[model samples]
Target: METEQLYREHRSMLIGLAYRMLGSAADAEDIVQDTFIAFAQVSEENVRSAKSYLCKMVANRCIDKLRGSASKRETYIGPWLPEPVITDDGGSLEGDPLSRYVHKESLSTAYLLLLQQLTWTERAVFLLREVLDFEYDEIAEVVGKSSVNCRQIFRRAKRGIGEAPLATPSLQGKTMELVQRFAEAMQSGSVPKLLEVLAADAVMRNDGGGKILAATKPILGADRIIRFFMGIQAKSEGAYSFAFTEVNGLSGIVTLKNGRPHGVMSFEVRDDQIVNLFYVVNPEKLTLLQADRIRPIA
Candidate 1:
């Protein structure tokens, strides 16, 4: 097959894998582009499976990126959340690689942060086996490990990461209503109403990347989270307006100030309550969520 054809068919998948691995869509695109450019120059006959070869290339590059950026993340400001990818709401992702891939719960900010707990190699092995469903032999080839080693690594990574706390599909079906209620409560400044939608032990994390003010540590408990928001509300003086939208495949809120992008808030829902909130205010991360893509929720 021609390299251009291969790229068109697999670019979205490749970007998905790299984005999960690196948590940076920008980095993911760069790595995939470089990989395909390198792939095109290679002798096609020598490459047996283009998909597998591309997967290996992207995965290996992500590993290198993670290792190189380890120290930078360690010194990052506030809690680290994955770059927010504003997904389409019954529309086209058009210019974004995440359009086709962000629907999976694995692409959610909460789940991606869980993947951050694993070592670079373990992350590669686990994603290959679990997310992509690559066979042990295929994963072994991708990571340059023996099939036995790949299996062991995957098992270990699974144990370490544990299960994500995202809403199950059945629960997810009710998320829109829940988020709507939450938004209404916020707009009305109804503390009691807000409490109704939040888990008692709900936690909120803010990532400003040191560019803007944000909480340095998580605010635990629904009450505290409410108070935190209230404080921000008071300070902002009604400057921030929120719109309901899809974020990382789940119902979330996009905040705009002065008709410009402000931040994004993605939720983890379980048992009809918002259990965890990932708020990313980092301007660099907010660039993808253009004003035209968001609409206010009434």
Candidate 2:
């Protein structure tokens, strides 16, 4: 295939891979662009498989970025959340069941955060094997490890991250229902209603990047979370407005202040209750939310 055709065909997949790897859409776009540029410079005859070649380039670029940024992340000002993306199409892979399962889990915020705990090699190996369904030998090629060693890395990555809950389509409707209720409670400043919807062990985590007012540590338990929201409601009366929207393929709310994008709050629902809430108030991370096409949930 022509270089342009190859790029056009593989761009979305490559971006998804790189974004999951690096957790930055901007970086992912740049890496994919550079990968194609490098691909264009090479002879088509030398390329055995365009998909594999491009994926290798993008994965390696992500690994390099991860390695370089490890220390910087350690010194980051606040809890770092993955850059949110609009996954209105459900972000499913167009393949067999295994591919769809992997693609769906890999796109979630919890899974991405779990990945952050892994070493660069472990993350790459796990993603290649578990998400991309690459053979051990193929993963060995991508990460420059022996097949046996790659297996070990994958094992370690799995043990480190454990298994994240998959929010299936069956649960989306119930989850959105809870989201709407939570939004309504917040709008009405009803603490009792908010507590009713939140799980007993509900936790709220905010990533303000130390650029805005946010709890430095996670607010644990339903009472504290309710209090936190109540405080906001009391202090910021009429200063903020919220719109229910889909974020990262899940029910979430966008907080707007003075017609500007201020923050995004995505939920993790289990048993029809909010288990975990991720609030991204960091202005830098809110760029994608601001720029993306968002439709309010009715």
Per-model C-alpha lDDT, please? 0.84, 0.77
- Model 2 per-residue lDDT at 104: 49
The TM-score that candidate 1 achieves is 0.94
List candidate 1 segments past 4 Å from native: 94-96, 104-106, 165-168
Residue-level lDDT of model 2, residues 164-260, one tens digit each, is 7655666567778998999888878887889889999998888888889888888899999988877876787467777776676667788777556
What TM-score goes with each of the models? 0.94, 0.88
Quote the positional error of residue 197 for candidate 2 in Å. Answer: 1.8
**What lDDT score goes with residue 267 in model 2?**
82
Candidate 2's TM-score = 0.88
Each model's total of backbone clashes: 0, 0
Sliding window of 10 residues with minimal summed lDDT for model 1: 165-174
lDDT of 1 by residue, 37-122 (tens): 99988887777778888899999889888889989999998999999887754565464566776645546677889898898899
